[model samples]
Target chain A: MNKKWMSITVSLVLVFTLLATACSNKEKNSGGSTAKEGGKGEQVTITHYTIDSPDRTFVEKLIPDFEAKHPNIKVKVTKAPYEQFDSKLQSSIAAKNAPDVTSHWGYGGFMEYYNKEMLLDLTPYLDGFSGSDYNIPEDVMNIYKVDGKTYGIPLNSYVTVMLYNKDLFDKAGLSYPPTDYEDKSWTFDKMVEYAQKMTVDSKNLEEAQYGVDFGFGERDQRPQYFGAHVYSDDTWSNGGKPSEINLTKLEVVDAYKTIYGLIYDKKISPTPAFSQTVSGQYGDPFLSGKIGMSVVGSWSLAAAADFSFNVGVAAVPYNPNGDVRSVLYVDPLFVLKDSKHPKEAMEWIKYLITTEIQEKSIELSGGNPPVNQAAAEKYYNNFEGIEPKGIQQVFDGAYKYGFESYNHLISNYSQINELFINELAGVENGDKQVENVLPDIEKKLKDLLARVNK
Target chain B: MREAALKESANEVRRMRKWKLSQIIGFVILLLVTITMLSPVWFMVTTSLKTTKEMLVFPPTLIPKVFAWGNFSELFTNTDIKFGQQYRNSLIVSIFTVIGTIISSSFVAFGFARYQARSSSFLFMLVLSTLMLPYPAIMIPQFLLFMNLGLHDSLLPLILPSFFGSAYMIFLLKQFFSTLPDELYNAGRIDGCSEFRLYWNLTLPLAGPALATVAIFSFIWSWNDLLTPVLYLDSQENFTLPVGMAAMLSSKFRLAPWNLLMAASILSVLPIMLLFAVAQKRFVEGIVLTGIK
Candidate 1:
């Protein structure tokens, strides 16, 4: 009887709790879909969707300024986590409730939307707007044009660079890697030498301090640094068509051997397991100060905001064959054609690239170089240890010799990368040699690429 | 005779010692299990209190060099995270789900078990077949249905379905209801109780343990459900704890703030822990009474 009474009491309590919440739920439900337009001069809420990035929070800070400038527009922003961003964006667009403005991952995403006719041609929205004010070069803007229709505006430029822990280099008594992109003295071998000196290996991986992490430079982007072209440059210019792949090249094979030897033979770099073990609980190993030099994209510069070590950004080391190549990535701002307020979305995107916003991006986004060459020249001044001249050289070398990365411009890139990574996993795991694995993947890679491109 | 009595006394003492030894061994074994079970919980609590820098060091410090009490404090004050709002959202959704599941599942189970018909058994089997359908198979059509009704990006989609009864809960409950003797209802009928009154007054009160078991399961499922909210919710203000926490540590372009995530996680799980602690006895009885493996 006591148990029965207790059960009845619990059920009664749950009923009361439900009643209380139902009332509040009614209040929230009544205020649903706040995006409706009001009077001629009344508030119009425009939804902006963005992914988690160094720029995410920085953009959040600037949103208030944007809202302040346009009193009639209330900008409601939703930031998806990095992994969920694509799925969320696709779903939102499919539901015909696409955000007014969003950060397009790269050229490929913009082109994908273009082929689907999902993008709003911002060319009409630009009208008399001068691209120069925001450091948007006409040539760069023209790069996004398809038959005289412009769908995207350059958000920022992310160039691959070597981010070294200056404190670790000093402790190891090695001179810092040159920030001068033109320096002939810095090479892959020189980097490995410096790396070997700093590496302190232990049977217990958690205690080991790695000398370097190539940060996917050792993956598909391998050919980029080695001056080997696997795909035709015309792929993007031809509306993201299938590109014939040629990975049997001597340079391509050598690039794989070089990166893998660093992991297996030299053992100076962290293996895949090392990174996962450390990164699962801790953040990035480089930020943990366990890594000496991490050759990665410029976006990693955002680590300086919280990183304890003195960090510096330098140009990538040249290949032993006297070739130099830096991978360049450009994030674009795209508004959907289905957006309720296209004009308002344009205003918000334009605000993201202003001199003030771009400059603050360095502080907030950590390392996003404003496409404005002048701003890019002064990008490193925002950080404590990074010198202005050195950072300028990093940008200069990129513009001089670097090509736009093919991943963002090609169709079925993420899929191609995934398949490539799966094939390359054994090499990284010390099971297979690059010479053996690279040959086998060429057909599989081409097939996957063709399947998606078609 | 005195010597014989002494031998018997010695035998009794040895027997007592052997019993005491087994008890000691049992205690040690249980202690080992307890420590093993609590290890991850200990790690979470410690990690929450450590600074991000300290947490990242290799061969990670078992004891933090610096105890960052600020991690928990930051969860409340950070403008980016609306912890209070999300907590309220989770609580409301979970509680309502429990109430709805308990009432609806029991009602359906009663009808299936008590009222017999030519097709009643077949219908129960049909209901059980729904348990085999994977959620992803139905996710799209359901999403489309909810979206058309303008319930997308709202709590309604998360709470409304609970009122219809879950197939798994219904099945567990049907089996439980079948065990109740028919004579109870027959006896109540003889005492002038209506069919509804028998269901309401007699069966429901006796169905306490089974109902409690279902309520607990529904509450936990709703509380920890990330997919429902992640799919349905758009605004941060509408997010529940699971979705909000996932957003914070979502390893995308941004690095996860592990310390803050741990702190929020510890705080987020307290209610579930408390619920279990408060209702543990009845919950165990629920499982035992239902004879569910």
Candidate 2:
């Protein structure tokens, strides 16, 4: 009898505990859904997932305004760190709870999402607004197009340029690199000459004041100067042989040799060793006043504006033979196919690209160069003190000369990048010649391509 | 005899000197290792107090020239990041996890330890095999299950899982329960005490160290867990500290504010450190008791 009573008591307690847990969970669900259905006539909450950054602040600031303007819609922004955003976004999509709109880069993962039919075809919405209303150039819009259908609206575009410290140039008694894109004198050889002069303690290279910091490995930037494409054909045809490894080409070899000279022969740039120690310690060697010049993206403008010394912006130095080409990084906003409110999401995206929002972005965040032409012009022309002179060149270079390499589109980019770096590591450390390693690297890359393509 | 005594004294002095020398060497080595281990923590604290400009300087300053204590204040006061609310959420989740894991795990462990069904060993092995299944393999399935149950976005997804005893914890507690004498249980049964009372009284009272061990592990695991919280919780008000700190480090437009990040990191780690310090004795005893028995 005692045992039976004890068993009954235990079962009752367990039942109550489970009931309590379930009730609490149900309460939370009801609470959230009720708020969504509250006062302003059936509010629709649109979730926006983006990276947590100062740019997020702009979104947060604009949400209230957006909500006030569109009384029925409430924008909920969830931000994760940049590193975790991709994985989280993938998991969320898999879980069938992806945000209505998301910020994505114009390359690799975006292409994957588009291929998977996860992203909405934004073409129908594009028809609502005229081309002139968007103000983004045709070529810029082409970046977000897959199979001749647009999937994303580019929020901003950034291009790499030679950012030099004018104070360093003056101290070195050298003329500034030309800002004009067509300047014949602003070639790779001329930049190298200037780098040599600007570099201090060329003999004791380890402790030397560097003339230029590429901000990344030489393989990424130096190849661009020589117009060395990673693939024989630069077109991206899905699952087709549009990609064939072309690392063994004479032009590509020459590009590698020139980069090798910059690191080992000229000693104008910091060695990989010096970079390992001081790169993060002194943020952006150019901004830290440690290097005379740096090849950096438009994102560096905010840091440049805060530099203690005067800064100068110029077109990236090109090879005399190669056409002027700057690497452009475009960030685009995409609406998910599973989004409950695609029309509303598109409206928000259109609002983001407007001149008013772009201008506010400039005032609040020292915004990225607006994709809208009028806004870009206003941003550069009205830009005041500390914005490095010749800010217009960034826009000019991007519009006229910007080219995104096949590297960004390739799924095996990190692997290919690793192959190049591993082969060049010996040359970078001054132990091997570029000529000796090029053929070996080309063989390995071809094998990798065959395997990856298979 | 006097000469012998003097010689013995000299030998004793020599031995003492040698002993002192070895002791000094050991102390020096230990001190060096401790310093090396503690340097990163020291750097984090100092870096938190540094200005953005100072943080970027090469061969980083061990001491900040301008101590920006405002980093802490800024972290607390940031409107976008509800640090206080997230801290509270973490505490709630961790507390429930600890209680649920202890109660459920001990209950399951007592059954496995005392019961003698025909397939008991096979069943035990089956429970143990779950430990081999990695979290990722079952993550999606578990997520779908929770979603079907309408528990997807709530803290219940994190909390309710703990109520079903974990394989590792159950294995640990079962081992601990087996070490106890059966006489206690038999004696309680003779006194007309039921199986439930016997477990509630005789076993649970004697399982203090084991329960403490389980509690500490559960608390720390739940507290530090990033993936589960990130998966389940979407709202900022419900976010855990790890996820919030990760968000702090990855900025899309501007450079990450390292000082504020470090300050938040330090604050997040403080609770775990305090918990460990408080329950350290029982934790160690539990491990030793389980290991030998």
Candidate 3:
């Protein structure tokens, strides 16, 4: 071999060897024992996977505090986008490198993880932790439990309510919609008629303002609204077993028709084309005083608050026959079964749920509407400029009726969400009518359930 | 009337002659197309400067209402997402990956391109076939392998596999190697240069454009990759920019601060875009060297 060529070959191999050694060094040091104090001080690293990005100031703060409190136990955190969280989580589970703890979305998601045998049962630890005393509703906790075995803790809870423009109400010479706190006279039809009355089109049909603004393209919001209505109002059977979910009931169909009519008969919503031109403009349309009312959540309460206009809050309109009031959704945190440090992870979860952290986190996040009843009492009951009026009253009325994603009941929820979207898109297309659409959906949902059950 | 018509026709001819109108028109069209293609990137850069309220304004403003230098400031202020650390992680991973990919792929490509062995062809085909397998199917198995190897969460999970060379890169390099005269290699053998020596000196140096092509491809792929980092890295300190950016989006109940996200995104892509611009000549030459046409 030529001396020059031989030297170059030797140098390449040398570089390759150096790289390999460096990589090996990195692997060796990447993880170390994060041994707990009370347990064997043999290093025990608690790897927590959450959907929270490293960028969120809250998480940046939370991790340091967590690490500081448990200096002996190393807390490692990984984050992924919400869109890919479930898939990435499932992959982690299958790989058995599943994190010791994870933050997951609401009960529907919590239930899926529970069924998969992927979550660590927290029942043994709950005895030491007084979770029930925290004023998180009994029903909310029940959502995280399966067969009376708790699987996770609520990290944050969100609920949907009727958000109204108070300024628009005043202009129309009408009072804010009432909840049980004032009087119980408000009914579903009355709410609809009021929305219709409040709707003001300009001098031309082309310039007409919408009465109510609703999220149209996204079908996920539909379930949050309808699920509450179905649970409270419908009565039927899941085969031989008795069930309250009967969409076939006249009153139930009427409720569906009434909600559907807002789009078709009223033409109050932005057309699909216009809405698509500017997505998520429901907030803009409502806040700009172009729409009189909207059925939005406390998550959107801050949007109205940011507006230079007046706004009010009310319970989600109730059905007098069913008498259902508010609908609630909560996002929770769960411990994975394959967690390397389940005990330490549970302690972290416990710390997060404490009244102190929950209150402070909620206050920092601007009106998360605390799950803890006592912490909630600390907030002003009647703040004039907070956008949504009687925020606490809405919180009080919230627990009366709650619903979760129908997809959560079944394992293949993504497929069901796709089916729901396509079916609703058809309704939006005006090809398959809403009345015609439900039975096909009902059959598909039942078929999905049977396959899963089998 | 005939005089008037003749005057108008002469005026038209004069107008065409003075402007060289078609060429200028064509150049203008090309310029417009280029600007149109680049507008989205320009928008991303501009939006990074916008305040949160400005980003969500109705009829979306083309320019920032207020420049939020704070977004860039916040990126560095946090210990959780040390922007410098993420950039270093990405750089370290990409540099190592590029070197590994080049060495491994060239070695593998030499066997395919120069050797007459029967199994060489078979092995090359086998490598090509791996591209067809859906990634998610083997995702669990790959994760377990890394876990068993105790490489999970470290740069090894992201880096070590590149040492084996990628099928696509090998194919690219092999195509270029094949186009080179066989006599040059024969001449190397006559000089008593071993197979390794031939590859190390004459072949690789001559294939500089192709090597640069593979290196740039490997660097960009490694830099922008989110899924691998998300799957492997288990600490904030370990996160690359993409994984860190994703976490930022989901962290709060309120929508992610668009200003911060856009600023971070722009910063994340700047190095890569700048690299592409700097390497444009070599990249294009490398593409042509591969004889992709």
Candidate 4:
């Protein structure tokens, strides 16, 4: 009787425990106000996931001001590192619990949400704000459209150009920079000639100073200089149209040989090791007047404002064939489809893209050249610094040289440069020919394309 | 002749002593190898003290040129990347996770060690096999299940899954428990100590070293995890330190202030390292104690 009673008590206890668990679960499920049911009432809290940390004093300042404007709504911003953002966004989207707004990297990542039919067709709201109101260019606006609708607003548009140290040019007794932006009568040959003239060999000869430096690290931007014209065949993929990567057809190989010549044949450019060591020395090597010229972004103008040397800017040099191109990449701001308060989200996004907001963001970030040409020109007129002069030159030059799309999806952009660095090193150190390196690289390029697409 | 032979033996002893001295030199080199392995962590700590401008310089400095104490203050003051809330959430998750691991794995391991069934060994192997399946393979399916269950965007998803007992932890505890004498359980049974009493009073108390080992491992794993918290937690108020640190490091334009990142990184590491130092004695004891039984 005692053993039987013990078993019965144990069974009773187990049943009671399970009942308690069920009751607790029911309470939890019913307790919280989830935004999915079109959250109502005053103090409607919305969650945002972004790569911006609240840890920055700047981010904290915006929250209280935003809350004060909409007393009934409180916006909470949550951030994680960029590396984790994609996976987190993916998982959150799958769960239908994603933040109301997210800062997307724009191209391939945005496609994932679009293909899943998880993104809202933001076109209906676009009419409320015009290109005039948002200060977004129609040309840039076209990049964000997909399948006859829009899902994002262009945040910051950037163009890549060459920033040169004018002090180094004056010291070498070279002519002053050309004032006319379109006149690249300053051809690739003149660039090489000036770079070589500016290079100095001290008395010891053990150490040498160079006139020009190019990035040769894991960054695929190094190869974007070559690949932009080579593998960019989007029109062919989308339609049956024969959109060709012009480099494979054109005599662009001659331009490639010339860049190789600048480093090896003329020895004017810094050695591979020198460029690697000084890679993001944005204002250092060139500003310190060691390197005469560098191919860098438009932001370099702002970075070099306080430097001791005078700065000059020019468009990327032209190939003798007249096919000159510079890359324009943008980071886009977007609202999630499931947001309960799409109107408020749209208002914030519209505010973020406005000329006033763009200038504020640029000021906060120190130098984002405005995507809105008129506003950028306005900013220039108001600005006191000598830095905006070069930035203004960059804006004028971009009209002729800039290409809208970039090769952000080139599979293993970082790894391709490893091969380029090796081959470039081989040419500089030995009796290797530049002509011999292209075939192997061409094959490697095809393989990378296959891997990424596969 | 006797004198000369004795002198020659003394010389041989001296030669052996010199050989031992060389071995000590080899051991010193081995100690240096261990220190070299630890140098990356040392560099991370020191680099966190450096100003953003100095951190990026070539031939990275071993020490800070200007140590900024404000980096720590900035970590708390600057942004919504709430280091305090994150630290609290991680502590809550890790504490509950450690407790769950000890309770569930001990029960599962006891059954494995004490039972005698034809399928027991097969089932044990099946559990061990789960450790080999990479997390990505099951990630999507598991995510959908939780979403349907309405567990997403909360700490429940992060914490509740740990209650079922991980196969890896169960296997580890089973290995330690298997080494325990069968005689102890049998004696308890004869004395009319219930199975629950045997486990609670006799088995668990004696398994302290193994329990300590499991607790420490579970705590570290949950504390350092970035992926799960990234996937489940959506609110800034709920973010873990790893997620916060990652956000601060992602920008391409205005370079992330490295000093603040470094200071936050130092804070993230301190508690875990302290736990490791405290639990290390138990870890060593567990390995030795588990083998003895």
TM-score of 1: 0.88
The candidate scoring highest on TM-score is 1
* iRMSD, all candidates: 4.4, 4.6, 4.5, 7.1
* Chain B TM-score by candidate, in order shown: 0.95, 0.95, 0.90, 0.87
- Which residue window of length 10 is worst by lDDT in model 1 chain A? A24-33
Task: Indicate whether candidate 3 or candidate 4 has the larger TM-score.
Answer: 3
Q: What lDDT does the true structure give each of the candidates?
A: 0.75, 0.74, 0.66, 0.63
Give the per-residue lDDT digits (tens) of candidate 1, residues B1-293. Answer: 99999999999999999989999999999999999999888888888998876766666777778899999889889877878889999998998799778878888998998998999989998988989998766666676677777666678788878888898888878888888998888999999998877777888877777887887788899999876676667776788988788778653344567788889989988988888887777788878877774
Superior by lDDT: candidate 3 or candidate 4: 3
Write the residue-wise lDDT of candidate 3 on B161-238 in tens digits. 898889889999999999889899889999999888788777888888888789889999999888888777766567
lDDT of 4 by residue, A1-454 (tens): 5467457556744653563355235422211123333345545556656665322223334667567777665566655566666676676666555667665542234444554455666788776666656667786776656756777777767776676777778888998545345666876677777888888744332245677765321232333444334445573234112133333443445545656677777878865555545444222355335678876555455555544457676666654454434566655666777776676666666655666656665565566666665567654543334555755676666655555433332333334445555655676554577567666666665665455434
Give a tens-digit lDDT track for model 2, residues B169-287.
99989999998898988888999998988778788878888888898889989998887877776666778887788777655345667888888889988988898898888888999
Task: List runs of model 1 lying over 4 Å from the truth.
Answer: A1-44, A52-61, A105-108, A111-117, A230-234, A248-250, A320-324, A361-368, A373-379, B1-33, B251-255, B288-293
Predictions ranked by DockQ, top down?
Answer: 2, 3, 4, 1
Q: State residue B133's C-alpha deviation in candidate 2, in Å.
A: 2.6
Measured against the true structure, the TM-scores of the candidates, in listed sequence, are 0.88, 0.88, 0.83, 0.78
Q: Candidate 2: give the clashing pairs.
A: none
Question: In candidate 3 chain A, where is summed lDDT lowest over 10 consecutive residues?
Answer: A233-242
User: Per-residue lDDT of A349-373 in model 2, one digit per residue for the tens?
Assistant: 8888888887776666666667777
User: Which is the winner by lDDT between candidate 1 and candidate 4?
Assistant: 1
iRMS of candidate 2, Å = 4.6
